[model samples]
Target: MTTGTIREIDSASVDADGMLSRTMRILGCFTADEPELSASRLGALTGLSSSTLHRILAQMLDLGLLSRTPGRRYAVGVRLWELGELSPLALRLRETALPYMTRLYEATGENVHLAVLDAPAPERATALYVGRLTGRGSIPTLSRMGGRQPLHTTGVGKALLAMQSGDWIDRFLAQPLERETMYSITEPDAIRMEIDRARARGYATTREEMTLGNVSVAAPVGSIAGLPPAALGVVTRIDGADTRRLGALVTQTAADLGRALRAL
Candidate 1:
């Protein structure tokens, strides 16, 4: 027996053009709304033939990149989640911020969130939530762990935006902001004013901007080594909510978490 290079067997389904790109295309088809997809649906979404789709799905399943579900549908595998947990944002930042976020939740009985800036460019920045805690008594929120939200419409988002450089902020505000609700501040100058207030007050506030009946108070966590800018915030029902008090609490918690991360 002699060692030899291995290659794919002759198959019309095999695509040699862009292995990485095609894999990403398949994975990207699964979203927060639809986590599991069947081969037919994936073929339609990716424009790949059934044979090619089935071949790639089989390879991904064996590698633990995807797993099969009932009715032959496939989902993101647990191995991907295990790898995500190894990221510094997860192991260090999210784990470190969990205790402080829990304290905020207990003190206010509201939805507490920890998020980091996901800015490839000034205009493309978003708040990427890393951790969230909510109680049964807490009002429902559109945010979830690992979800992205607009920086101009959410408290934690504005807080993160306030930490950017003046030039960066200028570029960020140059684009027209999307209006999430009637109360969402879409005017660039108005959002700039809110960012100014957040900078001066050590926290930011959003009153029914992201959702109709909720108010959020958030504060930025000062710089941490090897980590993107982060913020923590609380969301509660707007009625009878004391944003002032919540602001004070959020400010303190964010500061404390920043100190803890630096010490580590």
Candidate 2:
């Protein structure tokens, strides 16, 4: 393993023999960009020795926590997905929000997105996409159901960020903002301005910040007692798109969904 990987391993493996920690560390090696990895690659990335790595991999594979691909690479298994679907975020939130999201898509025929904050702490949070709807004519997006994105770059992310307290925002912004595109707002003050505008207008917008040639408008669903903070968004080609109109529609849809959730 590389020296950097060794150092990371040392730092993370304080409970070196803890099965839960080791399993989680192994799972963390998978990502959207690299969904599948060979045993050797897993050993290198996780800094687990070959023997230990193989042992864990064998157990995970047997338990259906992982699946082997045709090329002898491992991917997250359907069993994990089965477990995720049972979470309240999936059962209660997404199930309640889908009808409103479907109506929004029918109204605009655009890409509709639903995302939730992954952690209560702003500094550690990311926007986790839970549901998505898109038509053939809709502009493509990098976001996928079950994927995670930075809280500063996407419309749904910004909408969720706008709901946070000033101190929470400050703590979140203290971290280095990722620049997904040249147009992405990385400066803290500028992002704060965006958040202010979003709070005042009841929605947020991103102009080719996450992806080129696309713009998004979104609004938060407000907080529900049993649910993580969530938001709704629509993405479309920037050309001839009216952000204000879309913003209004998104804000209303998010509100409707929030009320529905509360009544349940």
Candidate 3:
């Protein structure tokens, strides 16, 4: 949305429901870049009156929905973990697939991961990445287990892009791609070419496109029981990298994981 329109909506929600507005604002404080927030930062973020923010935070803390950090910063709590653990989909799938992903990591000696496009859910732009593993001296990466990444940039991100319908692909490309790193692809045409390559080869690769000096390969693991296809993959350094060979490994790993998902 336009900056003005988003600002207006943010102001309008304040009048909608005092409690609900504060709750969403609290959650909004955590960004893709920042997973933790101090109460003062949250206050500045939501622009809610401090009294209201404090009360809401207190309630969330008492309920275990939020956890208090060393200096009163708030982070998603173990209660989220407890509640999420109750969801059979998240719990069972991650538990089932971790061993296989671990094996992939041990064998390839690269960061292994699993993720899916949010085709089934429209209200949120989400990627359900089940795992992320990094080794000592591995290239620094921002992706995390169960964390979300933009669909335009990362290896897992491009895998999501490749599975899109032609219309969806067109619409996605019609927008601007953000420049996260000097190596990231900011042009729509380049992303389109990469997506085409991913489609042809059954895997995706990025060379510092998401993070500098880090190269990653991702392969699609198609869905089971109507779920979106998942991306299972690995990440490594660009030095001495053979991207095509890495792509081959990712494709094989993704296929094996897809079979495991279907069997479960």
Per TM-score, the best of the predicted structures is 1
lDDT per residue, candidate 3, 1-264, as tens digits?
011112224535476655664575577666546668887898888887889889998998898878978775788877866886755446656666687788777877877877767543232344556567768756667877656677767788788777777777776666666788887887878888989999998988888777788888887777676466567778888899888787777787777877877887
| TM-score per candidate | 0.92, 0.91, 0.83
Which residue ranges in model 2 land beyond 4 Å of their true spot? 1-16
Comparing 1 and 2 on TM-score, the stronger one: 1
lDDT of 2: 0.88
Rate residue 220 of model 1 by lDDT: 97
Q: Is candidate 1 or candidate 3 better by lDDT?
A: 1
Order of candidates by TM-score, top first? 1, 2, 3
Candidate 1 per-residue lDDT, tens place, 1-264, comes to: 000001112223446676655666787777678889988899998898888888888888898889989998999887777887898989999999989999999899999999999886788788988899998999999998878899999999999989998899889889888899999998878988999999999999999999999999999999988999999999999999998899999999999999999999
Q: How much is 181 displaced in model 3, in angstroms?
A: 3.0
Pairs that collide, model 1: none
- The weakest ten consecutive residues by lDDT in model 2 span 1-10
| Model 3: per-residue Cα lDDT at residue 54 | 92
Better candidate number, 2 or 3, judged by lDDT: 2
- Counting clashing residue pairs in each candidate, in order, gives 0, 0, 0
